[model samples]
Target: MNTLSPTTAAQAPPSRWALASLSLSMLLPSLDTSIANAGLPALAGTFEASFAQVQWIVLAYLLSITTLLVSAGRLGDLMGRRRLLLCGISLFTLASLLCGLAPSLGWLIAARALQGLGAAIMLALTLALVGETVPKARIGSAMGLLGSLSAIGTTLGPALGGVLLVASGWQAIFLVSVPLGLLNSWLAWRYLPADGPFAKGKPRGFDLPGSLVLALTLGAYALAMTQGHWVLLLLAAAGAGLFVWRQGRVAVPLVRLQLLGDRQLSAGLAMSLLVSTVIMSTLVVGPFYLARGLGLDALAVGLVLAAGPAVAALSGVPAGRLVDRWGTRRMTQAGLLGMALGGTLLALLPSASAVPGYLMPMLLLTASYALFQAANNTSIMAGIDPQQRGVVAGLLSLSRNLGLISGAACMGALFAFATAADVSIASAPALAQGLHASFAVATVLIILALLISHFALGKRGQSGTPD
Candidate 1:
C-alpha cells in the first residue's frame, strides 16, 4: 500500500477548512440519530398514526445506515469520494425536504431511510476524504477534529433538534440541512483534490459479493445485538467468519482482512469497542437511574446527561495533541483506565448520592470519553492507508456504532437476568446492577483490547509500521 510523502509544514491545505466541511457532512447523521426521538409524538399527532408506527421512522434510519455504511464507503473509493459526497449530499437534502413535507407516516419513514443512505455514505467516506486531502503527518489533527465534531454533533444535536422542532416545527429540523448540504457540495468539488496517484490497498476495484456478504453478516449481527436473540448472535458470528474467509479469497475485497495482520490496528478496533461500550452503557443507565429510580424529569435528566459529551467535545483538541506526542498506547491505556475507574465509582455511589460527588466523576468520565475517542481515531486512521481508508473507516464506524447499540442491549439483558435471579432493585435497583454489569463487561473488553494493543504495537524491537 502506497502513501503520499509528508507535505511540508507550510502547505497544510488548511486542514481546518477540510475539517469544517467534513464535520458538516458528519453532523447530519449523528444529529439525526436522536433528532427525532422527541418529534415522534408530534409526528404521530400530525399524521394521525399510532405511536408504534411513528417509531418506525426512527428505526428505519438506524437500520439503513448500519446496514449500508460499509458498502457506501467502498463505493466511494471505487467511484470518487467527492463525487459520492456530492451525490449523497443531494440525496440527503432531497430526503430531508421530503421528510419535512411528509404528509403521512409511511412517506416520512421512507424519506428518513433515504436520508440514512445519504448519511451513511457521507459518514464513512468523509474520513476517507480527510485522509486523501490532508497530509499523513497531520492526519492525527484531522482525526481529532473529526472526533471533536462527532462529539459536538451528538452533544449539541438534542438541543439543536429540539429547538428546530419548537421554532419552526419538524420541518425546520430537516430543512436546516438543505442549504448546508448544497453549499458543502459546491465547496468540496472546488477544493478537495483527487489523490489517486498515492492510493493504497490491493488497487483493484470493489467486490459486490463481498460487500453483500458484509451487509448480510454485519446487518444480521446488528439485528441480533439489538434484539439479543441467541440464534441471531450465532448466525452473525458464522456470517462474519465466512465474510472474512470470502474476503481472503477475493483479490480485491470490499474489506481487506489483511489490514488486521498488524497487532495495533486490531487492538485499536477492540479498544474502541470496549471503551465505547462502557461509556455508552453508563450513559444509558444514568438516564434511567435519574428518570425512574431518582424520580427526575426527562428534561432535567437530558440536560444533566448532556454535560459529559459537551465537555468531551471541548477536550478533543488537547487529546489529539497528546495522541501525537505520547503515541496511542499510553493514551489508550490512560483513557480506558480512567473510564473504568469513573464508571465503577458511579456504580458504587450510594443511593442518596449528591450532585457534588457525581460532578467530579462525570467530568472525569467525559474526559476519558474524549481522550479515548480522539486517540483511537488518530491511531486507526494512521494505522491504515489511503485506499483502504474506506473499509477501515467503515469498520471503525461499524464497531463503534455497534458497541454503543450493544451496550444498551446488554444493559437490558442484565436487568432481565438479574431480575430472574431475584436481585431486588428497590430504587429501580436493577438499573444500577445493570450499569455495574455493563461496566464490568466493558472492563473485560478493554483488558482484551489492551493486550491486543500491546501486540499490535509490536514487540520491543520492531518498527510500529502496519504489517
Candidate 2:
C-alpha cells in the first residue's frame, strides 16, 4: 500500500465519488447510533429481553467503538488508511448483517460491538484522509462537510430508526446499513487510490499489553458507569495507572501520552468530553420527560428531539467560519454558554409543554455545539503532526466517548434519586430539580472546558495554527 500522498495537485480533484465514499462511510456509523435508539421497545419485544438489556445493545456499541477507534486510527497510520477504511467498511457491513440475523439480544449486542470497531476506524481516519487528499486551502471546506454530515447523522438517527421500526420492525434498523455499507465499500475501492502501508522501517509493534490495560480500565469504567459498580470503578483507577506506565515505556504506545502535552490538543480533547457529556445527557433527559412524564407517543417524542441535531447541522458552515476567524477558544466558550442557557430553559419548562419551549434552547445549544464539535476537532487534529494523525484521531474519539459515558452515568444516578421520590417526570418541579442539578454540573464542566481552552490552546499550546 502507498503511504502519504505526494502534496501535488493530482490529475483530478477528489471526485464526488470519493466524497461519496467518505460520506457513506461516515453515514453508516451515524445511522447506527440513533437508528436502533428509537426502535428499542420493538427490539425488546422481539428478543423478549428487558429494558436494561435493550439499552446495552446501543450502549455496548458506543463503548466498544469509542475504545477501539483511537487504536484503529493509529493503526490506520501505521498500516494504510485506505486499507483500514475498507476493512472497517467490510466489518461494519458484516456486523450489520449479523445484527439483522441476531437470535438473541446477546447476539445483537456482540454484533453491534463489531460494528462499533468498524465505525471507529472509519471516523478516526476520515479527516486524516482529507488531510492527505484535499489541498490545504480546501481542507476547511472538507472538514466543514464532515461536520455537517456528522450533525446530519445525529439529527437523522432517531427519525431513521423510527421509520425502519414502523415499516418493518427492529431488525430492519440494523439491515438499513447493509446497502449503505456496501455502497461505501464499493466507492472507496473505486475512487480512493491505493496507498502505502504505514511506517516502512523499524517494524514498530502495537502495544497490545497497553491495549489490554486500557481495555481493562475503560471497560471497567464503562461497566461502572452503566451498572453503577463502584468496585469496578476502583479497579479502573488501578488499570489506568498501569496503562499510563506502559504507554510511557512502549515505543509505539497504544495511546501516546505525550500527545496530551500539547496544550491546545489537550484542551480540545477535554472540551469535546465535557460538551458531549452535556449534549448526550440532555438526549437522555429529554425523551424521558416527553414519553413517560408527558405521555407523548414515541414518534412525536422522536420528532421533537430531532430539533437539536437539525439545528446543529444547519449551524455547521457558519460555525466553521467563526473558528476560522475567532479560533476554538471563543467558539467553544460560546458553545458552553449556550449549553448553560439550554439547561436554564429546560429548568423553566412547564409540565406537558409543547416542543417549542424545549426546542428554542436546544436550538441555541445545537448551534453553539456545531462550533465546538468542529472547531475542537480541527484544533486537535491540526495540533498533531501528520505522522500522528491516527493516534490523535483515536484520542479525540476516545475523549468524546468517555465524556458521554461519564455524562450518562452521572445523570443516571441523579435521575435515580429523583425517581426514588415517586415524583414522576411530569411533575415540573421534580423534573426541573433533577435537570437543574445535572445541567448545573454540565455548565461547570463547560466552564472548566473554556478555561482549559483559554489557557491551553491559544498562545501557550504550540500544536500549530488552527487548520
Shift in Å, residue 350, candidate 1:
2.4
Clashing pairs in 2: 1-195, 1-196, 1-197, 2-195, 2-196, 3-196, 70-394
**Over 4 Å off, model 1:** 1-13, 195-204, 228-231, 419-434, 459-467
lDDT per residue as tens, model 1, 1-467 = 33444452334356666667787888777877777876777888888889878878887888788878888888876776778777888888889889888877888899999998998888888877766666555655666777777888777766777788888898787787788888777666666654343246436567888777777776777778765677878888998898888888988878767777756667777777776776676576677666765667878888778878887888887777676666666776677677767766765666567554555677787788777776677667766766667767777787787778777777656654643443334355655555456555655766676676666655421222122
Model 2 lDDT per residue over 1-467, tens place: 12244543354346566767877777678778767888888888888889988999888788777667777887887777788899999999999999999998889999999998888888888767766665443444455667788879867887778888888878888898898888889889877766644445734678777877777688899888878899999999999889888888888787778778877777777788888888777777777666666667977887778778887877777776666656655666666777767766666666545567667877877777777776676666655687778878877878877887887778766764755555343464566566656666666777777777777765621222254
- Provide the overall lDDT of each model, using Cα atoms, as 2-decimal numbers: 0.72, 0.74
Model 1: residue 72 alpha-carbon error in angstroms: 2.0
Candidate 2, residue 368: Cα displacement in angstroms equals 0.2
Cand. 2 Cα-lDDT: 0.74
Taking all chains together, the TM-score of candidate 1 against the true structure is 0.89
Most lDDT-accurate candidate: 2
